[model samples]
Target: MYIKLLYSAIALVACTSARPQQLSLSLLPPAQQVFVQPAQQNNAIEPSINAINKPTNPIVVAAFQREALLPPHMQNSFYKNPKIAETLAQNSWFGPGEQHAVNRETEKIPREKIFIILKNAGLLPTP
Candidate 1:
């Protein structure tokens, strides 16, 4: 029984080790050639070009203006310094009692940038 098992294993090994016959490409039909046509240049002016380049929405323009005014902390809060915020609040023309209000406004600056980023990334729903 052991000899029969060994013979069967050897037969299995021999079958597995045999090289598979490869198909000849020469025997197959020739592939058809494809020619691509060049794109035609249009002389007509585009209707959307002006609209795409122009800032029609005042709200979006305001948002961009506010983005430009925002401090560096809004984009990179990892390097945020509390001392800078306090200093800005102190130097502002607001009264001493309004220092906290100034600080709060400074803190709020990043939220606009954060919301814009999140909305652009599709992580936050747009209003």
Candidate 2:
């Protein structure tokens, strides 16, 4: 009986410990490890001040302004509906003039530029 119990215990332990084998290595081809030359490293280490100093491209700035200002849902909605896009495109400011009258009265800034201004002011997130 004791031998049978021992054998059962051992079998139980073995069964519990058994696990499926896994692949040891990735299927992808081995990556080539390139050694960077010292001269290349030195050149790359210093960024060009002139490159950083360059003025922002107007088109890129406008695109970024558009990206950073509009919410993802609004952006999606605008893209989905031509009428919405037309309305948005036609308006200089968001919403009817009545809702944003205070903003209009307080800041002489045009409604079209308000989104950008609000984004710059940290009131809104990038779309």
Listed in order, each prediction's TM-score against the native is 0.18, 0.17
TM-score of 1: 0.18
**Deviation of model 1 at 52, angstroms:** 1.9
Residue pairs with backbone overlap in model 1: none
Q: Could you tell me which residue pairs clash in candidate 2?
A: 92-111, 92-112
lDDT of 2 by residue, 1-127 (tens): 5655554454334333322111111211113223232233221223222132544333333333444445555444444476774565456334545332212222332322433333344444554
Best by TM-score: 1
Candidate 1 Cα misplacement greater than 4 A, ranges = 1-51, 76-127
Name the lDDT of candidate 1: 0.35
